[model samples]
Target chain A: MADIQLERVRKMFGKVLAVADVSLHIKEGEFMVLLGPSGCGKTTLLRCLAGLERVDGGQVIIGGDDVTDHPPGKRGIGMVFQSYAVFPHMTVFDNIAFGLQMQRVSSAEIQRRVGEGAELLQIQQLLARYPAQLSGGQRQRVAVARAIVMRPRVLLMDEPLSNLDALLRLQMRGELKRLHHEVRSTTVYVTHDQVEALSLGDRIAVMKDGTIVQLDIPDRVYDLPATRFVGSFIGSPPMNFLEGTIRSSNGARALETAGVRLEFHGVPARGRDAVLIGIRPEHIAVERVAVAGGIPAGAIPAAVVVVEPIGPQKLLTVQVGPSTLKVTTPVDFAVDQGQRVWLRFDPSRIRLMDPQTGDAIAS
Target chain B: MTVAEQRLEQTLPPVRRQAVDWLPYVLLLPTVVFLAVFFVYPMLQAFVLSFRSPEGAITLRYFQAMLKDTYFAGALRNSFLLTAIIIPLQVVLALVIALLINTRFQGHPWFLFICAIPLGISDLGAGLIWSSFFTERGYLNLILQNLGLINEPITFLSFERPAWLYGAIVATEVWRATAIVMVILVAGLQLIPKDYFETADVFGASSWRKLRYVTLPLLRPALQTALIIRTILAFQLFATVIVMAGRIVPVLAGEAYFQYGLLRNVNIASAYAVLIMTLSMTITIFYLWLLRTKEEELGRG
Candidate 1:
């Protein structure tokens, strides 16, 4: 319900700067996810936004007013912690009613809000039950209900699904997305899980080293990663990097590295001694070659080291000289360990990356 | 029993089953025997001594003699007053110290060590240490004189000023025993997950609100434990009273000692001991009921 902005916020934990100079803008009622690996400062950023942590320098504006100097309660923010943080001593109803009571709402209004929260999270039957009686998923739902019952101007969730089992986590992910849609409260969700960020966020801010390395819609972030780190980081079995340099042979541009050559066109050749050829496993197509046929152009011949079956997709570990590439194919791809296959790299799909900056070289 | 447990019982061999049933009692024998010898026997002896006359017949003569003794009323009043004042004082003081330590303030381990150093000192040793601070020629008087706050040293331990003697003794007892309560409460504070407090903070609960709504509720068990033990110890105030207030204060334990050591009457001493024991047990039960943790609360959490 409020627009939250951070103007070059910086936070220091003793001598180590945890959240370096960073600025961000979250639109009203937007589900903006801060995603990164553990200790990537995503949680720290969320805490600063929630007013649970004070930024050492910079202004925090919430709903057109400065909230940096205000306490967490005055910030009009609600948070669901990773641990669920449901009050063990209180029943589900009491937990949800706590904030309303703190605000001195009437008993009738408290009941109405708590009932609505329970209904929203589908925890009405659990109203009288203690946290000890609830499952991990149930407790997390209670945590969500407790946060949203008071209708805080902004809601913050820190890896709320991380503590649940795999099946429950997936289920809760969908539930969280649905809840956000229903409430439409401006939310800042933090997680290390890429899939959660991609599926849940209207916009995902991929973070690294206390900075927003990339902020884009899920599709753009996946298809055209701004940095090599973003490209490698966002995928499972991550994006493969073939270390190479740009070769300019008579104005023809090609990247050559470790028994792999990807000849590319359209993008002008920038003279650089070193470049990284980045390709995702799913994007790398496996070509079926006739038993006695020679390898085709734009295809690199490789020997498969390992073929791992995961669900219907088979992950093939192919050896390209000293380097290996993971290629995803169908279950019935008819591939085995040590099988010879040609790896195809569509020039357009391949990302040209600067080795030094770890960023994709702009076309 | 559940159907599985019933089926399991049927499946087990009779010889092994009998052995399994006896295993618990066999494991419990050492503790039961030790308690009976060291605890139950003394209590029985004291009970009998307090209820009987010197004529070797069952009577309430010693109880009557104690009730009629000059120091009995004073001892009862003094003991009651000390416990009444010390229970809340120590609970609050120990809780504050424990919470402060739990914050993990800078140099927290050193601070915790300094706070708990008194736990290592014997009650008698603690009493003696405090005696020096309250004596007429001690550091307190010296400081007052040097600061020009007073022309002469104050007679803090003098019989003329019974209130000062009481203050010195009460302060000594509180200083000596509060550490034990604090150590217990500190452990209790640690048992509470930090996430609850964080949740409170996120919900906009002030620090005081967090303490009331989150901390005190979860700390019920530890508070109960600390209060029960401190109340029991307070009822038997002896060493600190002896060292600090000396004969000026007629506390229950001091009266028991006086009758047995000075009057050479075992019957009267045992009566006083029984009285103190009864009072302590009653208060212990009261504390337990006051802060009882429900069995259901511990189910999964």
Candidate 2:
């Protein structure tokens, strides 16, 4: 296993710059994921690291060696493509053994490695089957087996689970985590799914427009996103952003939007003007009774527009005024649509961003 | 009259359902009729004529005559020999050229246009062009004489050596047909996802190994299609061979034409045509079976 570092890497396709001046250092045996929306150049960056694409101007240093000009075969990196690109003509056994065979390993050794890889992937029974005969998930496993059989210094996965069904994707996600733990190989996985990035990555790099906006542990990225874009993109039922102007009211700073005024206890001095306030749905709490001291210190009164019961939790789409906010509450609360409720917003969970720049306002 | 009309309307099916059910057949009727008259009728006529005798007696005399004739035997042997040499050579050459064209190179369209030129040219035109160089007072003999390689012009297409005549015809035919195979193979090469090759590279596969393990295996369907089509066309090899070798080496088709047009023997000519058709069909079916077996093996792999 090896640590990979990209120094000021850039990729240009004709006049369009796909990846621009990006620098990242992935530590040894770390599972670093590049995550973003489509056309964000995350996959392009992964391809550049795999040597499938040449960087316009940069050095790719792997395990202390500068491999900028090296071909993919010499880079000691195995890759599983999004399409599962398993050779349609070869059996699963031959597919897994392809790398070893290319290395001119003995027949017995090839059989051993392929057998081991198939067993590791739990696809031992599918050894004689071609890719066309395998289901989507099975084909993906074979693709992974083919990559891992080589035992390269690093494993690069380009959205390998994207082709599988929902249930299979979830199962494969767990399998991938387990595989990473067992192998402890330095892996660079690329995906646009923020959920996968959050759940699977040791370090998640949130990217936008060919640039890395934030790179941190999953929880850190979710809890304290560096930018507004990172805050909005990394969460499920994503963080809501409200346009408001920060104002000082009675020795306290507050944000006033079109139909509501929310007092901010810890308002950043830099966001004294127009700012975007972000709050995750899970942070807001709903209660049936307005008990004395029931609402949090900084809370707002709102009317629930719609209540969607999602098994264990109730997702309440609440409207403070013209603006709508989603609040997740326990299912036992029994809140109905059009019911009045007090929303308790945790000031600690509030994220402030510069309206123009979309950067986090320093507190 | 009004009561009778109402009864008739009740007996008729729904207009929408009838249109939906009959529309497809109505659209297909013209094409079916066209094929029946143009293809099936002519084929049946050829088959019936092949069995008739010169004196209008039902006899196997023409078939027996074909089996015994030295000229017929030579034509069959020459056709097979030319097919065996030309088809494989053309396929391999086309594959290489297709690979070269498939690369991300400048002037790719121009190269493709140039390659497709021979495909647009008629076989007879191609043969005539090549014959100019092979003639005694042609460019090849002139160059050889100037280089002092030979004292006199060598007759490359005359009856002196029928093998050279047949060889020249095969070469010209290959030149005319290779472009088609190249176009098909090029499209097949494009269907292969780039990631497959990248994966191979990641495994440190050598160029030869990649070609053997990745390229050739993926090219099976295209190769099969090319082979069947080329084989069928090779059986009908007429204008090019006739233009190059004339009567010295008559392929089956040319001989069939000769028997009908020169000898005025319709029975023998029809028999030859039937034999050619049967041979083409058998070869096509044999190749299709081989392809099916390969597909089954692939499926079971």
Candidate 3:
């Protein structure tokens, strides 16, 4: 319902800076997620937007009004905590009605809003039950109902699905997506799980060490990561980094490592001695022999160390010289440990990074 | 082996296994005997004495006498009134103070130590210390006079000013008993997860609403425990009342002591003791019943 913007926001707890010089703009009705590891300041940023935490440096503008100093109640934002902090004493009905009651809504209006929230969440049957009486998934739905019942301008969730079991987490994630579609309220969700961020967020902001490393759509963040940290953090088996030096071979630019040389024909000349090459596991192809004219680029002969069978695919841990890389192959592929295999790297997928600064080198 | 042959083989005794089997009860015998002699016997004796009369006849004279006497009735009334006033007040005050101290305050450790100091002091010592301040020419009156608040010292211990005199003693007792409740409530407050408060804030709850809806409900167990403990201690308000009011406000325990030691009426003294014990048990049971109801609700939830 409202656009939330943070301009150079910073939060400091004494000497340690929790959120350091961050800026983000979330449009109305967008489901934006702050994704990062623990202590990466994702939660802090969410809290700042919710007005639960004070920003030490910058302004939080909501609906074209600066509301950095406003308390959470006056800011008109609803939040669901990770622990499902539904009021233990209050029944489901009371918990959902708390925000309306605080605003001094009339009894009829309060009941109507609460009824609608419960119906939207499909938790009308759980109205009389206390928080402790509900299952983990039930409590989560109740927490969601409690937040949405207020019909605030923005809704914030702090890892709401983390507490549920795997099956329940998947179920709740789908339900949350559906709820967002129906309500279409501006939302800011925080979580450490990259998969959840990719699945739930309309726009995902990946954070690291108190700063936003990258922010874009889920596919763009995953495939076109701007930084090495973002690339490494987003994928499941994670991106592999190989330390190498840039060299010219037969007038073609190539990256030379201990056991492999990867040539790039389309890459622009970057006059550097050392650079790190990054490639996702799925991009690297495993074959029986080094094939001719395969991208005319990077290829390595490595010994497989471990093979993990994951139903549809097999994740192979291959050792090239002293460096180990993981590659996803078909489960039916007959690959054994200690078996010598050739890995083909797609030249376009190979990202070059500066060794010293860890920044991506433009091709 | 045949059945007879196996039976013969099993008939052989094992000394070490027998000793091991008997070892646990042997270790527990001393504690069992100690409790039987010191605790069980006295309680049984008290129960039996409540039914005995002066002529050693099985009579309800003691109960009738306690019910009939105005002094006895007054003592019971004072006890109930003190409990009714003190328990809730102390529990609520302790909860607020505990919340204050639970913050990230600079001098929190020092404040906690000060709160716990009264608990270490004996009840009699606390009574004596308060009496020194409340006496006719005590430090309180001296301070008041020095401050030009009063022209002459007020006799706080005088029996003529019945209500005011009794009220001062009750205040002293509250001051002495409040620290225990504070300690218990503080422990309880610490156990509530900080995330709950944060969640309440996200729900747009004010500070007062947070306390009423989230805090007080979670604190029920601690509040109940503190109330029951304070109420039971209120009935034993002998040392403080005696030190402050002397013979003016006779609580049940004080009257029992007076009947036994000063009057040398063993029958009546025994009757008073039985009556006090009965009152203590009844009040304790009532509080326990209330606690049980809350606990059942918690279980249902």
Candidate 3 Cα errors over 4 Å, as ranges: A249-251, A290-298, B1-39, B54-57, B68-70, B149-151, B288-301
- Per-residue alpha-carbon lDDT of model 2 for A1-363, expressed as tens digits? 999999999999999888999999999999999999999999999989989898998989999999999998889998999998888877889889888898898999889988889898999999987777788999999999989988989999999999888999999999999999988899999998888998899999998988999999999899888888998788877887777777776766776665456655667654357888888999877665555555544456788898888998888888876578887988788777888787766778888888888888876
Model 1 segments more than 4 A misplaced: A255-263, B1-41, B51-60, B107-110, B129-161
Residues B114-145 of candidate 3 have per-residue lDDT tens digits of 87788887778888888788777889899999
- The two-chain DockQ for each candidate, comma-separated, is 0.48, 0.52, 0.50
- Tell me how many clashing residue pairs each candidate has: 0, 1, 0
Q: Report RMSD for candidate 1.
A: 4.5
Tens-digit per-residue lDDT, B1-301, candidate 2: 6999999999998777433578889999999999999988977877778787657777888888777866898889888888888999999999988888877589988998898899999998999999998999999999999999999999999898887887788789888999999999998999888888888888889988988888887887888889889998998899998888887886898888998899987777888889988988999898877755344245653
Q: Where does the lowest 10-residue lDDT sum fall in candidate 2 chain A? A: A289-298
Could you tell which candidate, 1 or 3, scores higher by lDDT? Answer: 1
Error of 3 at A322 (Å): 2.2
Over A228-342, each residue of candidate 3 has an lDDT whose tens digit, in order, gives 8888898999888888777776877766776466655545575786877788999999987545534333568789999999888999999987789999999788989999888
Write candidate 1's Cα lDDT for A1-363 as tens digits: 899998999988988888888899999999999999888899998888878788899989999999998888888999899998888788889998888777778999999999999999999998988888888999999999999997989999999999999999999999999999899999999999999989999999999988999999998898789998898789888888877766667867767665556666634456576877788898888987997777677688789999999997999999877678889999989987878888887777888788888888887
Candidate 1's displacement at residue A191, Å, is 0.8
Tell me the whole-model lDDT of each prediction, alpha carbons only. 0.87, 0.86, 0.83
